[model samples]
Target: MRIKTKGFKKRTSVDEALKILLSHTPLPSIEEIGISRGLNRVLACDILANIDVPPFDRAAMDGYAVRAEDTFGASQTNPIYLKVAGEVKIGEAKEIEVKPNEAIKIATGAPLPKGANAVLMYEYTRELDEEIEVLKPVTPGKNVSFKGEDVKKGEILLKKGRILKPHDIGLLASFGIEKIKVYRRAKVGIISTGDELVNLGEKLSEGKIYESNSYMLASLVKTSNSIPERKGIVKDNKEEIKKAIKEALSNDVIIITGGTSVGKRDLVPEIIAEIGKILVHGISLRPGEPTGFGVIEDKIIFMLPGNPVACFVAFETLIRPMLQKMQGLSLMAYSHYLVAKGILKRKIPSEIGRRDFVRVKFDGKYVEPIRVSGAGILSTLVRADGFVIVPENLEGFEEGEEVEVRLFHNYFPAP
Candidate 1:
């Protein structure tokens, strides 16, 4: 194969490249799924409450139901006595009435009896056979959970584009909602291409390395709440890569790793341009400058670098947002990553025209930038806690400067 010496004629800015990709992305079709499987799925439509939550006036505590006036002026010095009329347990449907000067035993979450306005705790009353002595005055509506207190009928329980959570599922279950309308998860096809790549469990030859980009990309897809279909590996040959691209067009998005730069072996970009329109072929970003994307048969195709760390950065910076948009979620919906401010332990060097993602280890008090000679060093990502983005306008950050670090894992405890 003849090598091409010409580099990228012009590289697009990171912001412009992302804008182009999102313009071509459309929300996936909606589907009705059971609430049991709705966690992390985006809602297709606003869900309105058909009935009020808690459905009725109920007791918030285990106590005796009685009219407020009946317990008025009751104290330890001068206790008021009332007849014990009946009892109400949780989920019970029997109608019980609290007549004047009478009290009924009620359990927590049980429906408040008719003609009762308040609940006097058992601690304030002494059970004396058929009657009880009230030692504390009770206020109206005390210890009572009124109907629609949690959710009102005809109110919006959840809005469209909301990502369902465990508590959301429980809330839907409270309304007896078996199924909910949610956006369908996007099906992503991942294709890894290179001549020196081999799958796991295969023999390790002198010139071949185990392919890992596909596995890493697949996990990133899952984190975006999408399904990944691994298309396996294809050699650098044109015909083989073309066939793989054609087959992967069935997916909503196609990610081709390796052969994305301007080299003779970088046939993936040429094939993508031949079969479809290459919208953005290069970006002004560190480690992922060769990253590019296009559209084929209405499917978005991403050409990522073979280096594992570069592939990860490209996916997180560009592809992840598009995937989220396809699933009916806002681009910033999953932007709840933990951020911490710390003093820089060392200086970070960068160019002014390119955006740089500097991997750093944040030790609660200081942000230490991890230096790597090349983007192929994937171990740097593992050793670092998170990364800090240096914008294109600025050259770099000085030591001792306070900077915000975006954490890779949000669940990390406070330092």
Candidate 2:
């Protein structure tokens, strides 16, 4: 899987390229992390409950614990009365027994006393000195949460490869799971190449642009729950680029922006072919046609475009999914990305045999496309709300046509 000296003439489809890249990428390693810090981390193995949730049969309502038979035939017109026993407080293990014709005042979540089979809510009864009146009858086990009712001991609570949420953390804590095994986050090394590029805080000279793709890619990696190692800037020289690539190979994934296009300084593909294998040199996609991918020493390398907007699109569509795959997530889970439908404000022209991602501003009712010829226009991405994809087989979208828009924000505009 190496690129020839003549370069790639036929571009690989987006789906086929992703299949090849993922087939080579392996699941990340596992580590034992404290449950307190497990948010967004993928579980490495199935998590079984070691103990029953709630731990015991407890009260589900604030009421009197009594035998269901005692309240039989009791009603508002003609009520039954019982002797009041001691009160039961929550978290108390003190033993208290209920005798026939007797009731114990129990609070919500308080354990039911021995000889008690049901709870009569306080609303259904009233106290008269040393006696309690039951206006309603309760069946056995009514308002009582039996032991192991919420979660039985040894029950599988969470499955492997599941992304942990706040509720999952609480459940683990409930079972006294202080630490858990989770897949280690993929460490991605971001390298920005080209002598024409300058880092932030440096004044831009003629024919130089401030480096933004590295920072953009870093944020993208962070949002995907991965570690981003910004390798700073590198010149287009083969030795310098090769040295940086070698250094970045230590990470689990390598991402190089710039030097991926067909030009004299575009040496990323050539250098990668020399050190390792270039699995994909180009993809059939608009705004990111120069996007490439390869492997160096078993680590996957993504060759992204230099333009900030193109870089952002390529990362979100291609690299982000790859990162998720490496962390043990299934392709089905990838569909959870925020997507909404909106009416197109205008027609979007596209060429056949190439997929296009057009940035659009969705103002609840319609999605207006941001028209820009240069892929380097970064402001359009900032001002736009989301993007709409046009398939390679279609020409474009018609005005007022409903289309699916992948949102940058998690929420859709209110109607």
Candidate 3:
């Protein structure tokens, strides 16, 4: 095929592009999974308690089950005696009725026997071989965990769209819930394209470099709690790029890095337009202007710039939210990053119409910007701690201005 080169007639703003992308995001399907594997998974439906937690009245402490009236006026000076009915260990189901003036030894978590209205702690009672002396009195229902006290039957335990945590799973287990309905993990396909790219572990030619975009994109997908399928590297040829995209349609989202700009080898946009609809082709964002997205057969397709830094920026600004939406998570949630406010140590320049993601390091006191002219400098991302976003409405931030920094990594260096 003949090569063609073109220029962007118009570019969309970062906000508008993101709006278009999210409007086309499809809802994730639901699947039944065991509670053991539900951590971090989104619930598809509200979890209603089918049965009350602690199913029956049980002992909350190691004590003797008795009637509250029988322990009245019992103290160290004058003790009341009761005949020992039987012993109830934890998880035992023996039926031992506490008759008048009768006490039963009950272990913690053991079911309270019939006719027992309270429990007297062992510390306040003296066991005298078949007869126990009550030194203190307990009110009705004391030291007893009532049925449905923790969770009531037919009550909403957890709401829909909630991200399951370790404690949430434990709560479900307490209710004897072995399996739950959760949204299925979105599968993302990542494809890197370029004739000058070579895979790792292979000999590199003079003009070729090892491909790294797919690996980085795959890791970003994993961070969003989605499955990533690396489609391998494809040359700049139109047929190869088209074929790879066609195969990646099996995934819920397809991310194609490189070959998205308005150049002779940038054939991805043209091909996607031929096969489907291009929602947005160019964005007004620094380091990621070539970022775009489209749809084919209901599967969302993302066109990311080949430059490593540009790829990273586009993923954070655009694709991350899309993945969160796909997995039934809130788009505004940034659980992986820690947000902090710091004063700028120096000024950063930017155009009025474009948004800029300036990488910066925080020294507990001031935020220092890491200067880089090009988007291909991957080392800048590693050297910097986090990034500061300058919105399109502002020209830039001046020195000593307080700005919010989103720390991608856990370690925040102190001054």
Which has the better TM-score: candidate 1, or candidate 2? 1
Each candidate: RMSD to true structure? 2.5, 3.0, 3.1
lDDT, model 3, position 319: 86
Misplaced by over 4 Å in model 3 are 1-6, 333-335, 411-415
> lDDT tens string, model 3, 259-362?
88888768998899889988988899888998899999989999999999999989888988888787777886344578889999999888898999899999
- Give candidate 3's whole-model lDDT: 0.88
TM-score of each: 0.96, 0.93, 0.94
- Deviation from native of the Cα of residue 376 in model 1, angstroms: 0.7
